[model samples]
Target: MTIRIGKIGYLNVLPIYHPLETGEIANDFSIVSGPPSALNQLMDAGRLDVSAASSIEYARHPDKYLLLPDIAIGSRGPVQSVLLLSRGPVDSLHGETIVVSAQTHTSAALLRVLLAEWKIRTNFVTGDATAILSRGERPQAILCIGDEALNLRFHPDYPVRTDLGEAWRTLTGMPFIFGVWIARRDSLDRSGQAVRRACDTLIRAKVWGQTNIASMCALAAERSCLSREELRSYFDGLVYDLGEAEKQGMTRFYRHLAEHGIIEDVPSLNFLA
Candidate 1:
């Protein structure tokens, strides 16, 4: 059986998937693409054997998945894609409604954690921030992720923009992992070799991607509003590897989530052996 892998449809993930798409790394696995939240749901529902899912998904159901080692979507600081855009200062948005993107789970949770850290409480509603903004209806704030955040990073309407990754780094002094590659536990049990092979292929693809950032940026520029230089800078800040520091950051995030009742408890990082 072909291993079904899910890819996040975001430019931030271009480095990893570009190589695979360009035949830099040859593989026979079936790939599915969607936003992180959709991929998380696919994994949860057993429709996907493996995926780069939101970090919160694994924290929510660690028993159902085994993490693929050495690969993640993270940033040391200033992730340009996961942003909180507010009309005024974030601290002053208390009691106001913030429209959150329906396509996010981890970023939304992280936003709550950051707001709580600042001792701010704001109401949240789920809607399409992009559509709302296009219609000239401004909510107090909007939490955006992926491509939408990149496009709105410099919007004139929201003068105050906060990069969640940067905020998390400031609050924790470590890299923030937003997405992690995970394999369904039962899929691994049934097709162990295929699952491992897919993981190895992803790691190899990531290696090629890390070395070819310029090429990736060139390809990404065609589909993005950002210039190549901006895309290069954006890619430079991203961390694709789950190193020791990243693991520590992820654990800290999970602990905070649990403390705030965002998740039931901190989960053990169960890697595929």
Candidate 2:
């Protein structure tokens, strides 16, 4: 059976997916690409056997999925692609409206955590965050993630920009895990060998992609507004490994989420055996 793997269609994941797309690591897997939020929904519905989905997805439903070992999309500081742009200071936005992109979950939740920690109360509405700015209509703030954040990080209308990863690091002093690789538990139970084989292939692909980041940056440059050098620097700040520190970071984030009532409780990380 062909394993259906979910891929996040963003430059941040190019390093991991480039090899698979180029046949550098040959496989018979079927790959489905979408935004992180969409992939999370697909994984929850069992439409995807495995995916790189929002970390919150796993925290919310730990019983239904097993994490892939040693892989994640995270950052120690200043993840340039997850940002909050504000017309005024973030602390001053109490009771003001903030336009949040409908394409994210983890980042949006992280924003809420940060706001709560700062004792700031703000209204949130899901819509086209960019359109408000493009149309010269300034909301109190706007939240953007993935390529949209990268594109709007420097927009002049919002001078007060906060990088969510940077804020999380300042708050927790740990790496911020945005997305993680997960496999539906039932799929593994039914096709353990195929799932494991696909996992191994993914690990190999990650290793290759990390080593060939320059090539990946070249590919990203052609499609993005940033130059090759800028893309390299952006990728440099991203963390792909789920090591001890990354695990601790994830746990810390879960704790904050639980404290803010964003999640029921801090769920334990369960990896595929």
Candidate 3:
């Protein structure tokens, strides 16, 4: 049986994808790639055996999916890649419309929590950079995540930029996790030995990538249009290990989600053995 795997196609996932892209991982499985939201949808549909998904997606249905251990996309603060841009005073964005990137769920949820905490009221719409940049009347703000957020300049851009990761840390004093690897609960039980292969492969990729970040940053720089130093700094701020502190962060995040009535309840974190 051919094991299926899904990965985020954004630059932020390079460390996870580096080994896979370089053929360091065994080539026995089929790999699917897309934005985090797409991967979440595909995994929910059981079209993917394993995939990276927004952390909130897992929280919403933890009973249906098992987290792949020890790997995640997280930041303690100032995750330069997850940003909210505003053209006016941040406190004054209450009644305005904000264009949110369609590629993420956790970041979008985080934004909602932030707004609610600030007692700010706003409307949201799904949009990409092109749509936001070309609209007749500019959006009061735009929430950009992943690779798209790395390029700070959007055509006809807004003036203010807030790093959502930093905001979360300052507000809650916890690291914010954006993405995690997961698989259908039943899929992990089927034991095509597929999940085993995927887990080993991803762990290997992460190890290799972290060990060679400097070189990886240079290569990513060529494609991302950011200087190698900038890419290095960005990568430096990201944490791949889903350790104790991250688990706490996840718990706190879910609790906040429940408090805000964003989700039905805070699901327990479950993992595949």
Name the candidate, 1 or 3, with the larger lDDT value: 1
TM match of model 2 to true structure: 0.98
Worst 10 residues of 2 by lDDT: 129-138
Please give the distance, in angstroms, between residue 198's alpha carbon in candidate 2 and its true position after superposition: 0.8
- State the lDDT of candidate 3 residue by residue for 25-100, as single tens digits: 6557688999989988998888988888999989888888988889999999989888898888789898998889
Task: Residues 5-110, candidate 2: write the lDDT tens digits.
Answer: 9999999999998889889999898999999989999999999998999999999999999999999999999999999999888888999988899989999999
Question: Order the candidates by TM-score, highest first — what do you get?
Answer: 1, 2, 3
Flag regions of model 2 displaced more than 4 Å: none
- Candidate 1 lDDT (Cα, 0 to 1): 0.93
In terms of lDDT, model 3 sits at 0.86
Which pairs, if any, clash in model 2? none
lDDT, candidate 1, 109-200, per-residue tens: 99999989999999999999889988989887999999999999888989999999999999989999999999999999899999999899
Q: How many Å off is the CA of 188 in candidate 2?
A: 0.3
Tell me model 2's lDDT, rounded to 2 decimals.
0.93
**lDDT per prediction?**
0.93, 0.93, 0.86
Q: Least lDDT summed over 10 consecutive residues: which range in candidate 3?
A: 150-159
Q: Which residue pairs of candidate 1 clash?
A: none
